[model samples]
Target: MKMNKNYCFIYSLFFFVVSMFFFLFGISIGFKSMIYILEWELINLNSSSVCFSMLLDFKSMIFMSFVLFISCMIIFYSNLYMNLDYNKNRFIILVVLFVFSMMFLIISPNLMSILLGWDGLGLTSYCLVIYYQNSKSYSAGMLTILMNRVGDVCMLMSIAWMLNFGSWNYLFFYYNENLSLELNMIVFLVLLSAMTKSAQIPFSSWLPAAMAAPTPVSALVHSSTLVTAGVYLLIRFSNLIFMAEMNNYLLMIGCLTMFMAGIGANFEFDLKKIIALSTLSQLGFMMSTIGLGFPDLAFFHLLTHALFKALLFMCAGVFIHNLNNLQDIRGMGCLVNQMPFISICFNFSNLALCGMPFLAGFYSKDLILELSLMMYMNKFIFILFFMSVGLTVMYTFRLIYYTMSMDFNYNSYFILNDEELQFIIPMFFMVLMSIFGGSFLGWMMIDIPELIIMSSWSKYFVLMIMLIGGWIGFELSNLNLLMNSLYLTNKKLVFFIGNMWFMPYLSTYMMNYYFLIVGNKIFKSADSGWLEEMGSQGMKKIFDVMFKKNQNFQDVEFFIYLVSFFMWIMILFFLIIFKM
Candidate 1:
């Protein structure tokens, strides 16, 4: 069979779709089994050790279904999105590999397989990000790769520690082993990895930089696969984290990342970059839930975020494509009159992203906030959560207002066509899902009607804060004084954060002046000195003298035997010492 390049791309897509189908089918079957088991009131955890070991229960099935479903949708979305690119085949291959890696991560039965998939997913995302090979994309890809490797190393070390000193079993055996100090250190390292992978503080600049990739790749990675891997790991190893009782550190990191990213998003003008920062903020919420021992809430919010964030990215892609890759919100205006369908769907997704009442974002986000209050009872974390929610609405509507509400002299040259409509349709379905999916899931998950009503208090308060923040952001965006002052203040704040409070600059100067400059000059001069040069020249001379002349003789057996005897003596000496 002759292999065609285009056929390869097609096959890649078909293979991914089939893989996704089986994954989702497995989840559905698991769900059915759960229902039957629940109905008959049976406990079957011990019947199948493999299933229990793998965590393939109702909770895992629910999350796996959401992940696979979104993976399939994004694959479909990418098909249309990548049509104009020249390297469509390569893109498809990486996309398929990315999805396959994520599925493997979710279904893996042990830490080793999970880490294998985790690293694969990270490497594939790095390739996809730099696929364009431009300076910005290349730089962003390199930074992302570097930061994720730091996290990967932490995870690998933790796993190794567990295997050596703690647990070698597929299940968490260390928790029962009474190794408190070792287990706590491992949990801390894993949490550090989670923070880095999820783009928490100090490692978050890479994610905003990653906006240079194609929108679909950014959407798929930041929304569903790569970034979420950290949270999934935390949830998977909840027992270890809880055992270490490191919730305070988790809560603090989550709250700080949320506020920092939220403030950063408010300053962003690039359409996709705004969404990217919003993802960071949303991820903080998920992490905060995990910190509160509410992995279920975190998983719920993850599903809601995947739907709306994907929709937002796809919609932004359509606008950029129609406008010949123009990305600034200032370059667009009154799109509602031109692309009414897209405008409506974008608004719906944005609202859901903003956590408007009864929407997908509302249910999961409310649950997270409620759980946060219950777990921490700290005003600072709660306030940060509220402020993040408000800022989320602020930036989200800023996107809507600038793109759809303002007046602009749009050229008829930039218009959506049938090909673009294909991309929009998937987003339309996502908007529907973002509005109704959460409510349906909420009904299924929670049985108390009053609990739902109680959850509404948090929802209503968040909505109110969102409304206020939107109004303030809209007003300030239009005013010269407030905008200029806010910009100045933001620059100062970013400067402080970027410099790590000037300690980095101090350390750099110290290393350069005291170590690098003096050490390098001294070392160079010493190397060039007569004694060193003589040593190098003498070594080369010795080598030449020893090997330059060769004599061929059949009577060289004695020399060979002498050399073998010396080698054996050295080997025996080293072996004796090594054994001792």
Candidate 2:
């Protein structure tokens, strides 16, 4: 348990330096004109031989740049975040390994390399999640490992299927050319894997449980590295899914997950859990964009989300670290006057998260909503999208209000130390980015057609809905009785819908008929008198005869061995006679 400060500091510094190098390299590559420049051969290695390949063009460079930028921020944040922890050395090592894995994932040219990097990330993250080794943290880490392993299995099967029918090269290979029933199965399995890893729907419960880890781990895992892997997979395979025509199903699942997680966020009191659920909801939005065949939108949202969510979680860390580790929003209030700097930064990030105009989230989320509206052509999907957006604003502001509005019991003279400042500096930069990064990117010369088109009607309609929903949520917060009433109503509806329209009686009926009644009978039959006893007795007798024999048993064993030898000789004699 001895901490190694020197090792932690050195490795952290090394990771931060290397990550900046990659970021600069990616930016240079992204802006270069490959069409005008002469082609230079890049070396690529494989099992058979080393082959020459061309360097990455614009698209690959963009993703790589984003990955590097996020990796750098995460490493820099971890330097201060892990300083006081007992296992600082281990934390620094895992953080560097995580960055390396993500770098490999981004630069991978083939599915095999991507998967190799993907598994590396999963393994390192699992270890980091349980770094505390408390019972709750360990259990949460185990659940994450198990659920993600299921995703890994699905991915492996998909790879096998692809290799069997298609080529090993994931890029440039047209999946539609070899589309078949089997290929469709593989596609479904791959999508399932993406959903599980992304923490969508039924697989989402594990993410909230993962809040048992330190706040920084939650920030990194939820925002940048672990959950986003699914989004990366979908982005990489957008062409294949489009070719297979599975967008409709994907869209449905994404919409459902987004709304459900949004609603769940409304009811959460735990600050970290709320952020975790928000991460799930935002990822669902990204998946929906991918489902709608807009990988660019997904990528844009992913970038904006990482910035704001990381800031928010780090701000939460500041609050927790200041208040002696209190996580419940209800327990602490009116924090803005006390922690003015952290409050301002947290509010700026939350504004971006709430998708307020001119913030990082506005440009990306607006683009997604516009694309979803255009592609699905379903009013219901649009309605759900708006509702989720509304819920996002509601819960986010609720978090703000609960944290900064009620009361400030602590002395107003509390100050942040240098270690805290290390965490805060990155957050301040993120706040600035959340305020301006989207607009800057919007002005950049990228082919985002969705942003180019201006529809007055669509704009008015979306703005009106968002305004109304925001007002409703704001007003509801003032009326205690009405708020409780609405909570009860939503509870009933959610329970009914979640139970497949059958209320409490449905659960009772299923349990009585399927579990209690039928299960009991099956268990009774399985443990019945004659067959059960005979089986148990037979196993015991076999072991006894083999290991616990007396003189009589030894004689019998010798006779059996002599008989086996005689039989072997007789068989050999018969074979020789036949041959003669």
Candidate 3:
């Protein structure tokens, strides 16, 4: 126990110190508007060099710094959160590996080199997801890895296609102003890869299932690093996408993802899953922003979202910890009365998520919304943009109501206290960051002022939607808890929408069920049945019969042959004499 505590503290301090240095360096790099590429020649091929390269600039440095910082906090929180677990040291080690892999992904500019970090994240996260070694965790881990592997394969294809350019240094190609059909294909593949990683549209089911991992792992994977890796990759390739005229597709995908996740979260009752869905919604928001030709705004929102989301997950962990590991929101009520400080932090984070004024989310989210309105979008995209926004607030308020407003619903004997300094301290620090991280990042990331032209109606649209959504959420929360057991109202509808439009089922079961059945039938009829007899069994039986006949013939041969030989000799002598 003491050893685990010491490991956590040491790793946390090491990451904190390193993060500060990287953050400071990133700031300086941003001020100068400079990029430094470090390259090492691994081998020289015909007319090309396979080099390991790292790109150090404002974007990579700043993102890595935040990743390390969040990792530090999560590890510190884990020391107490995972105290009862036997393999705490192994957990810490896996987390450290995950962080470094993210850093490697952040720094690499070469496509070939990027794969090392890319696969590292997928592999490390799979291990972390299955750390508990239970059936549920194993299922989640398999889904997570298999979904990510789709992205991995797409990236490998992209790398192979990039070979036409005679180099794996993607940054060089990106800046060379080359807009060929090949580049478009490459960008399209990259989009698919990013979509899978970021849990967009068809690939969205894995994000919620990933909540089966421990909360700290969720905080790390969902908030900043693993999921956002896709967003970051697209941000780098935004120029190519725009040149290839693919932003429209990206925009549609993003809008649908945002709306789907927002609706799903409202239907969700599990504490961690709701947060996970919110992360998905925010990711959709970022992707849409990128699609709208404001990559910097997307990046700004990504950083800000990471802060608040990580803090939110940490707070949820504390609640679950004190509540004896119950994660269902219906089991919790009036938790604000017992753990007031954590409740405040949790609520504030949710509000920040809802884009409350002056909080971290508001700084970036408001601008994105306003910019979205200013753009020449169709009526449906416009409606989806705001409806998704409203749903965001609606679900948030619903969550707050279920956990904070109602009377206590769970076991009365449970103790809900926030005295664990390790947990509280990390959440406290994240609270401060989630409050201010947005404005600081906005100022630092956005070098030029964005022009805005909107009427009065446009200005008030966001506020109106939020208010209406909050009201709806309040009304929904007032439902008869006694009559409706969380999921009993229109069971089929709730079940369909609540399960992410049945995506998990579609992705996991429906996609494979028929194929597996056919495969089973084929195995029975061919490999184990008719094919077995016709191929090997029939040949063996024929050989066995032939061998038996030969054995019988050999068995009679000795005595019968002697008698026949003598009779044939005497008959042959008489016949020969007659013939002669």
For candidate 3, the TM-score is 0.89
lDDT of 1 by residue, 1-580 (tens): 1233344445535655664665565457654764221112123333322121244555555656666566656656776667766777677678778877887677654655577777998899889889888988887787788778888999788777765443333355543558777778777888888878888776776777778788878878877788898888788777778778897788778878887777777777788878888898898888878887888678778878888888788788878877888898888888877777777778888888887889998888866665554453678777887887788888777777788877774565665543465576567678888889889777755556534334556646655787898887677666748777765878877666433343324334564698779888888777666557678976878777766543333247668988999999999999999999
TM-score per model over all chains: 0.79, 0.79, 0.89
* Candidate 3: segments with Cα more than 4 A from true spot: 175-179, 481-489, 515-580
Per-residue lDDT of candidate 2, residues 1-580 (tens digit):
2335456445545655655664555456556744212222344334322222223545455555555555556556766666677667677678768767776666555655667777887898888888888988887787777778888898788767765544444553463465567657777887898888898776776677778877877777776677888888778778878877898778777888888877777677788888887898898888878877788778878878888888889889888887777788877787776778888888988888988888999988877776555553578877776788787887787787778776655555665333466676677777887799787666552443444454788766666666765666556655658867866878877564433234124334553698779867876776664456568876777877877667678899899999999999999999999999
Which parts of model 1 are misplaced by more than 4 Å? 1-55, 165-170, 174-177, 374-376, 409-413, 416-419, 447-460, 485-580
Q: What shift in Å separates residue 506 of candidate 2 from its native position after superposition?
A: 15
Order of quality (TM-score): 3, 2, 1
Using lDDT as the measure, which candidate wins? 3
Candidate 3 weakest lDDT stretch, 10 residues = 480-489
Clashing pairs in 2: none
Model 2 misplaced stretches (Cα beyond 4 Å): 1-13, 32-60, 409-419, 445-455, 485-580
